[model samples]
Target: MKQKTIYLIRHGETDYNRQGVVQGSGVDSDLNAMGQAQALAFYQAYQHIPFSKVYTSKLRRTRQSVQCFIEAGIPHESYEGLNEISWGAREGKMPNNFDNEYYSTLIKNWAAGHTDYPTEDGESPDQVAQRQKPVIDLLLSRADENPILICMHGRAIRILLSWLMDESLATMDMYEHSNLCLYKLQYDYDTRRFTIEVANDSTHLLALVMHH
Candidate 1:
């Protein structure tokens, strides 16, 4: 059976990420200094791979994170469907005392099988899954024999992975994704099963990290 491979990449760190703020689709920020280096490392690592196509979210963070790859001559596309879920009112605000509690409750609800429990002005995990599925399906359908590289936000990537792997969002949360990390998935066209070949690989960023 022929298998299609998808390489999922998390966007490089942003200023909000460095400050520990909740930054959703509400604000579009560029990559921080560390992020730029990380992106360069990622590009260098995968420059040898023969990627069929490269995809990224419409957000600047994801765009800037993958700029190195594009500059290196890789063909790329951007999709709003790949954008991160809106944090709404919480956008750039630091969480209030009750906000953390509320967020925890929401996660609990989701883990308990409630996919519709959304934040006051934010999206639920299920909603994100719904929005991201079509784009991913389109990619999978078009490139059944080619490998694709996708650059997207952390939360969006997690939601997409959960839907693709048929796992609960909570389970998907157990894994951590660093800036410019790479994850690879192989999907079997015959069995309709997707297997992870690699997850959260940051070895490419090691040299840069050690030096800086």
Candidate 2:
């Protein structure tokens, strides 16, 4: 049976992330200095993996997160379907008391299984999952691309893993992640099944701790 290895990671942190501001697909923020360090730490650790291809969301932060791999001349592609969920009116809003309350309520709703709920003019979990289909299909359709490296957003990763693992959307939060964290999965073509090898592993970032 043919098997493929998947290395999935969330994009590095951005100023919006540091400032406690919301950054959605529309924000298009860049990574901050610490975020860059984290990226380098990850690349230095995993560059030997010989990734057959690299994938990232259309968002700048995601591409920046994997810039080292791309710079190494690895084939790379960006897909809008992998972009972050839109926070709509809240996108880029600095977290104030009201915004904090709003986010709490939003999380509450989602936890209650209202996964289809969206912020005003924003995207729902279900909507993001729908759009992510093609990129996933493209990755799976290629036999030559093994050990793929994919970089995307946090919430989007949570949602993506929910369906990919056949878990209910309500439990997506179980897939906790941090900037540059990696989730490893194995896909078996013969059984048509996916098995998780690692979840939210960030041990690669230990190098950064030594740096400081």
Candidate 3:
């Protein structure tokens, strides 16, 4: 029996993130300065992990968050299935604005256990999980290539983990995912099961965000 390990990370923060704007799959943003520092800090901490491959969403933020590893000559690929859930009409809206009724409602509803509820023209939690199925399938198929790193979006990361853990998407929010935080999963080929080894760890980035 073979064992495989996966290191999962969420992309660092972007300008939209700092501005409290909704940036679902509809918006493609780059990592801000602090985000870059976070990414670098993450890399320096885990540089010895001996990852054979890197996987990222087909989005700039995810790519930029792991740019350090890419530049270091690690082989990587992008998967469209790993993109964030779409926010549709609310893509660029600020969270606290006076007129953003639907956005607020959506958040409240999602938190209130309406995970299947969708904003107008957007994706529901179920839909996001549906699309993410392929990425999961691909990872399972490549279990022989152990110790791969995946950089993706926040919401998408939660969805993927839920699927792997055989848990409900509603429970996914129980996990915290700060920028550059890592989640590690171990797959046992013999039983064809995955176990969570680490969840939402950011200890490696303490120095980067500490108050001076």
C-alpha TM-score for every candidate: 0.93, 0.97, 0.92
lDDT of each prediction vs. the true structure? 0.83, 0.91, 0.86
Name the regions of candidate 3 deviating beyond 4 angstroms. 97-104, 111-113
Residue-wise C-alpha lDDT for candidate 1, range 1-212, written one tens digit per residue: 88888888999988889987878888898898889888888888887888878899998988888787787777889998899888777788877888788778877887787867776788887888888888878887885437888999887877778878888776657657888888899988899889888998999999996896
In candidate 3, what are the lDDT values of residues 59-131, reduced to their tens digit? 8999998898999989999988899988887788776555377766766787777889986788998899898
Q: What is the TM-score (0 to 1) of candidate 1? A: 0.93
Q: On a 0 to 1 TM-score scale, where does candidate 3 land against the true structure?
A: 0.92
TM-score of 2: 0.97
Q: Number of clashes in every candidate structure?
A: 0, 0, 0
Off by over 4 Å in 2: none
